[model samples]
Target chain A: MIKHKALLTLFLSLFAVSGLFAAKPVPPAKKAAPPAPAVITGLTAVDMPYDAGNAAILKWAVNPADAADTFYVVYVSSLEAGGWLEADRFVSSAKTGKDVELPFWAWDGSSLEHAVKVELNNTYGDTLPGSVFQFKVAAEKNKQVIAESMPVSVTPVGNWFRLDRMNNLVLLITIIVIFFWAVSHAKRKGLFIRRIAGLDAIDEAIGRATEMGKPIFYVPGIGSMSSISTIASAFILGEVSKKVAQYDSQIKVPHYDPVVMTVCKEVVKQSYMEAGRPDSYREDINQFVSADQFSYAASVDGMISREKPAACFYMGYFMAESLLLAEVGATSGAIQIAGTDVEHQLPFFFTACDYTLIGEELYAAGAYLSREPMLVSALKVQDFGKLFVMISVFFGMICVVLGAKFGWSAFVSSVLNLFQNF
Target chain B: MKLIKKQIPLAIVFITGVLTLISYYVPHKVSVDYIETMNKWENIVVAFAFLLGLISLFFSHYHKITRKADGWGYSIFVFIGFLAMVVPSYTSHGKQMVDGMLTPLGWSYKYIYTALSGTMFAVLAFYIVSTAYRSFRIKSAQAFVLFVAAFILILGKVPLGQIIWDYALGWTGQGVSAVIEWIMQVPAVAGKRGIMIGISIGAIVTSLKIIFGIEKQYMGKD
Candidate 1:
């Protein structure tokens, strides 16, 4: 009986402990959702100007409070009912109209408006030109949609003219007018071009080669024929070939571009014909070297060292290989005349070459060598263009300074914008 | 023959040139498509032109070998190099990687071609030093000015030179680097801009002359 009483007391104590640890019922806390963000206003979609009818620009006014951690997601749909595709997304503060690169004349570029360019021909196949499309934007914060914009419809059409590039067009037209005027003036009065020492030395170099009974190597450079420098080099080559033929000297042209070699064959042939030495003309004169830059330089360097050509003419576009070729020719004791528009390589040529033609001088070498009225006239046009640029820069600077001093912001901006590439 | 050789080419040049100029200012799809097509054609033509280069290389090297010209042995190596790259490229179907590993052609390019190219490029460093030595010989007034400018430029760029400059001319607030920056920004930029402007004008006028057929050097003599 005593043991039974002790066990009953222990059981009662355990039940009391269990009752103390059990979970108790509590009132459900009042949980409320955060307030919804303000809807974006003035939502509009328009065709992107100066593009190929494949993109639409969506714009809207954003609330100032939604600038941080707020994203604007753009959706595009061909049909208004369904098939909405997420086109692009960006932070609310990004890509304002003021960030658009369009000129002030073409676009207002207001700071209050947000802009997004949506390409229709994206991964989703909505690339039909002249097709109407619907666009809508949604504002989201913390991965939850806070507000949505009304769907706006737009039709992207290809524009014929780029209004933003009007400044460029005007400049081009002015250049064309000046070119014609200079041409007519040149033909009538005969333009005067300054003497270029490098070109004047061409005949002497060829003569030296002839006297020494050694060939003259003309490197047309590694540039393709489409390059302006190569075209200019070809002109100089023609004149040089004529002189070489007249002097009855051998000329070897090692080429890096095959098309240039083919064109050069005709040029050298024509020069020979003009010099009344077509019999002396050889197709082997223009040989193809390796297309690889270093390999080409190495081959030419080897040729210079072996043949020890009395004169070497390095013309056209060159890269790092300029110094290698010039130095080898210098070591071979060849009178080297190098011409290129590559400014960085000019120092190397100036150091290693006997005569170096600087930037515009290389361009002018052909006209200076040939003394043709028409070609010389082009040089005159270039001079006038430079003069116009100088005057404009000086006048623009003065006007800008005065405008800034007098608080003429509009005038100053107009003056500055006139000089901008756009 | 004259009509085919000269007239058609000139006509094509004029049409293409004008169209290209107009395309720059036109935003129409047609203009964009035309440019894209022309670029594609140019790339195709350039690829075909490579064959011409290969043929020319083969014939020239063959001629040199047959003549037993000086360094004729080098010409044989050209064939070896060409075949080394071309045969593997053909076998690999022009794929540089196979099963996440470099193909034989890729190996040749990485090992032989790249190594050779780098070696050749490395030689430029020596040449630069030599060229600088020759250039800064103080032969004339212009040379002296160039030497002074190069001295400051080099001195301002290195740490030891900067320390020396600070020690020598620390009293002035303006450092040698500031002077160098001014020189680069003011004179260097001004000269570069001037050259750029001239080059642009020259390129434009030359293009016009070519389109008008006044510059026929590219087409051979008149």
Candidate 2:
């Protein structure tokens, strides 16, 4: 009975200890699904600016606290399809607010390029031109979407006009109007234009050729009529050929292209006729040279060495052969006058040629030589356009300096924005 | 006859020029499509004009040969070369293989034409030296300035400049190169940009003149 009592006592003590320490195993705490991400706020869509049309812009703001480091995927759905397709995706960690353009049109021949990286600022491209598109943004975390933005809708249309380029359009119209006015003004009378020594020396060179009884050489360059330099050179050639005809001096023109050769032949002939010396218009004056670059330069150099022309005219679009021709002329001691719209070759011509017309000076030669009000007016308008650019740059620079000096950050930024938009 | 000579070309120029201007600002599908079509047409036209150039070449050489022109000997070589290449071209179309290699025409182009062109380009090296000698002569204030700039530019291009600056002049590293860079980047670029602005304005004026028919010398009527 005493042993039984002792066992009972031990069992009672064990039960008391169990009551103090033992417990039921708690079920594993359910992993709480990430709290639904805050909805995208202030989502709106508008037509994209300054493009050939069929584009939309979507803008939205995300509470930085809600979607701080989540990857957000943007989905676009057309109204007819009624199903969302992935258009672009971005990570909210890179940006909290967004202004995105939806590319909605494509040209027939050109393929549009699109970028989807969140950090890369890019355009939306390759959407159909005439469709309404709906866009939604979804925030993703840990391989599960936690939040979604309400869908925004927009219809892209081909605008007849681009409003963002309005400033440029106005500039164009103003220039045109000024050109017309100047043309009319000059038609009534004459205008004062600066005399270019390179152009004026053309007459002197022709006179020297006449005195020497030697031929004058003209290189019409390698480019064809499609090149502006070639056409302008041809015009100047016409004017100079007229003077040459009047002086009864022979002029040799070697061509590099067939169409340019044909055009030049006619121009020389017409100039001869206009100068009342049609019989003097020799067909051989403008001869066809090899289309090969170095070959033509060598041929011309050979001619220069053999004939020893008194005057040489290198005009139009020249290339690697520019220095070769000019150097040959220098050795021959020919009165070389070079004119071209090519900037890279200008230094070479300037060095070797006695007279060099640099860049726009070549374009201005025709206007100066012809002195027709129509051409002269173009010159006047060109000066005016330069004046506009100069003024704009000057005012912008002043604003920048003043803004920096006085610490007017707002004024500085506004001016900078204006310049950028322009 | 009047339409062909003047009106048609002018109308085409005006319409196409205005359309191109419009396309720059407006990205409409019709405008884009028109531009693409025109670009293709331009390429086609250029290709056809190549034939015209070849025909003219034949006549030019023929006329010279018949007349026993001063360079008549060279004319024969040109004809021979032209025919030699043309015959092989027609036979091979530049793709036919010969001896497990490129065709004879391709071989001629690669070995003969390319080598000759490269040789011609290499000759410029000697020409530049001679030209530089004549050009660097200090005759005037402007020329003196140009000569100095040219010297600096030449010095900066080679490592000898750095060696001379560091050893002889007791200067630090990149001394000559830094000055040259500043000159090229600041003064040279500024001058170049000014010239570019002038060129752009001139191009605009000339293009406008052509579109409006004010510049007709190119049309062979002036």
Candidate 3:
């Protein structure tokens, strides 16, 4: 009885994998066989990395030669759910032709790798957390399943960390770590930020203003409180107001924002207090003009013409009003020192102003002026970061040259691809 | 007072800032909703700020008029202008934006504010010409180069420039337009990109500083 049971088990096992064990006889050549649909060469499902689970990347190679109007019903089979299941995923796109809902279109047919991410959903349209999911893509033609993809599985998972964006995160952490490290080290050693010429000219400009007894006109940009440029301007304002307090030079700050006015008052007052001349600080020196841009420009122009301020500081964010203020200052023969993050406007400031800090130099102004160890370290780290970028740029240039001149473009591209965030 | 001055504001900034930072990485529902809430709060604060701004302006102008200080005569005009803008809005019930031309407030905005604003913008055109003349002067080698570039740009834009180039070159190569395109697409773009990269890095570092509370100069203290 045991031998008979064993024989039956062997027979069932052999029957289960009969195709693999023994080939079927070629019956009547091709006449008896029905015409099968186009073959799906490769069926692959990879876990869609860096996603919030419930999705699996399904890749397949389809015979473009036998392209016809047929819907490819895509599904994922996972044992976690009962058996085979359908999903409502993010990358399901349907555009006319086959309604396969391809995530992307193939520009080239033969060389195309059709990769789609199938999202698994429950009965109630909600994302199912990643499980061992296998892809089963079928070509349905005329209400019948004609061709089916080979059994291949890809389990969608929610990665706690995005491996693709690891490079960027690492670089950022490195920069911050280096910056703080430099800050702490410099704090001990005593940091020194190199003198910025534009900032250096501030003292001379203020002295001229004091000697002439002319008020110094300052425009803290048109932007509201959220702008970094405006914030940088405020930091610089603290420094400038201190100098104004020292020389007893009148400083006029016409504001574009009311909130900025409040902030500037505090900053100016702080500066005066720090300078030990708190009596010189006045609220009238910093007041909000009209919020209207052109009106503000007109008023500032009028003030510049009438008051004839000996020096003008057009710091922070600026727009079309940049050239207007700088030009009037130039014509009035006031020493203008302008620093802003706006690059396009830099040319205008450069032409019309006595000195202009280009782009990042505006951010570096506080450090340069304060020469505080903490701020100086930031500038130093920025310089170091710039050096790293410059080195990368140098290599990038060489790679481009070699890629263009020689046929070693693939290796260069591969290297470039590796450095990308994704 | 301590809470308002230090604790409460800092707490708000920290909580809101950290949430916003997290939202960039996690594209989940909760983060998105929280960000939306923060945006709503921002709008409300700005609205209140605008209201406060109006009051501040009134007080400042009032002081100037009452004191009869330097350029005090200008204060009366400001009051007159304020009334001119406000009275119409009052009549229009703050529906000036969508109110028809028949409404006095809308009419004032259309006829007066719009006209003045347009004129101001128009004046910038003349200023640009004057400034360009000063900027593109051929004094030094640098100035000479700038002058040449300016000449080419001006020539490339106008029809006369293309005509001159076409006549001179005789179809042997591209017209002034091609040279202009090359200059803009290559050298100009290169310089712009460099400046942009520097600005982006500065912005990133500054933002990190602000986020980490290392830089708090804007908070009205050291």
Candidate 4:
């Protein structure tokens, strides 16, 4: 009983100290008077190129409230002669917010007659107009003239695009031109594209799994349904499922997105029906895991381990999880074919998978498998566009080399300009 | 009836495509309104699509858990986690209940999913080293050249390359760095350009065939 009482006393003392340690309420700070308006902070004026005039940018800071009803009256004076003359007027209230830009007439810099002045105002009753002091900017009765900031000198820089940034534009145009050229060339010549060995290998892979009496596992990537890479993956899934159905081999499609899972089920079901093996297809074959990135990876990894499928197909846009999924399949001694557009993850896949599809090859999977004429035709056009771009690049290089000595050949410059402008 | 059933959706799609294309050029208030309407329609469609995903998820997992298949415990974990996320999301409450709840839950999700899963991926670093050590052996003269080029590229990308050889730093020299850039600019870009060209042509032809009814595979076999 004595020990229990002492323990209670100690607990009470600890509670008291915690309460004391709680932060003290901070005192309210004193409010400063709202700032006076029209304190000009910046001025930029430059001589207009190929013209007799100049352009200037004037900036000033004002009370957030005063900006609602203020107007700046700009005045100019010759530095040789002290008196100032009115040059331009800018109203602040007409635009969206506090910031306003005004255009003023250019003054020749040779004339010392270059000084600017400004003013601020608020709306009041009729006949209440009064002048506030020029320099002080503060007056009596809650109205005060704000002090003017030191005027800044303006330097004129013409509005011109940088040469370096134009290189990126040139590159973009070249890419587009090349893309179109290759496409057109392919279309005109009826390019006889060969069948991708990796595609024929899919059937062989599925057949081996069937022969071995083991199920096949397929992951359509961790990307959402809308991604092009994921869509391509779905197309491949359709083809794979058809093959699996014909072989009478069980196939599992573990999905990251629910919509993708539904689509996968439809495509799988359709493929089975088309292959005359509808009875062999199971709805359970296509499973929807969580949409959360890591959760989905864990679920897929779990599915792979428990199923221990003979063959695994990894197709879609993948991140860091690419290696995790591929490595696990490798460990299971399964033949893995992985395809993705993510360049950085390619090395991981190349090292892990039996067959790897590079960037645009993922898109080509449908064409390679289905041999649909439409797909082949489209690829042909894209090839032509690429060729066109390459030829243009070479031609432009030659022109630029020659034009360097001829003082800007118009034709060469124009072609270069098209690339630069594009 | 046929027109209403078939042509109406086609018409809607066509109109939508045209309007979307026109909106890029139109800068008018009416065009802005059309664009806004399209955006709102898309948002609503997306929201409804999300329900489809949710249902599929529940159905998929519910079947697994109820059947007591292998790893049903994981399904139960998923179901519980799904409920945990869904409950707080719909609970109309102050900042603490909604925002603060995600902190712990997200961390748990990350720990279970990313970090542990990433640890599995860390094996790649070792695997790559081992794979390179084993498979990158040179057998032929051509293989030797390829191997040397690969070595230079690997060296040039890392910081240690410049430390080992200053020539690797020169922009104009025909050093390893310059060669790597040339390879990327020439061969890599050429291949990419070729692929892109082929894809565009393929897409256009495919689209035309689909429209003209020349490609009927997508319509489901009779």
Top model number, lDDT: 1
- Per-residue error (Å), model 3, residue B202: 1.5
**Model 4, which residues run further than 4 Å from truth?**
A1-191, A405-413, A417-422, B1-39, B83-150, B153-222
Q: Model 1's DockQ?
A: 0.51
- Candidate 2 has a DockQ of 0.45
Query: Higher DockQ: candidate 2 or 4?
Result: 2
Per-residue lDDT tens digits for candidate 2, residues A1-422, read 99999999999999998987887678999999875646667666655554545556556664555555567777777676577777666666543222222211211111121222221012234545337777777877765887787888776656666555555577778888888888898898887788899999999999999999999999989987778889889999999999999999999998888778878888999899899999999777887777889878877887898789999999999999998888888889899999888888888899889999987888888889988877887888888888988998899999999999999975876565454433
Model 1 off-target regions past 4 Å? A1-37, A62-69, A78-94, A121-130
lDDT at residue B153 of model 4 (Cα atoms): 76
Chain A TM-scores, per candidate, are 0.85, 0.71, 0.69, 0.55
RMSD to the hidden true structure, all candidates: 10.9, 9.6, 14.6, 22.0
Which portions of model 3 miss their true places by more than 4 Å?
A: A1-61, A66-113, A116-164, A400-414, A417-422, B1-19, B96-102, B166-174, B220-222
Best by DockQ: 1
- Residues B1-222, candidate 1: write the lDDT tens digits: 888888899999999999999999999989998999998998888788778877888898999999999889989998998898899889888888888899988888889899999998998898888888888899889889888888989999999999999998888888998999998999888987887888888888888888888788777765
Question: How well is each residue in B37-117 modelled by candidate 3, as lDDT tens digits?
Answer: 878987888777767677777788889889887787887888888888899989888765652345778788988899989
What's the distance in Å from true for residue B18, model 3? 4.4
> Interface RMSD, candidate 3?
2.6
By TM-score, the best candidate is 1
lDDT of 1 at B52: 85
**Comparing 2 and 4 by lDDT, which wins?**
2
Q: How far does residue A253 in candidate 4 sit from its true spot (Å)?
A: 1.8
Candidate 2 deviant stretches above 4 angstroms: A1-47, A53-56, A62-156, A287-306, A405-422, B1-4, B96-100, B167-174, B220-222
* lDDT of model number 2: 0.78
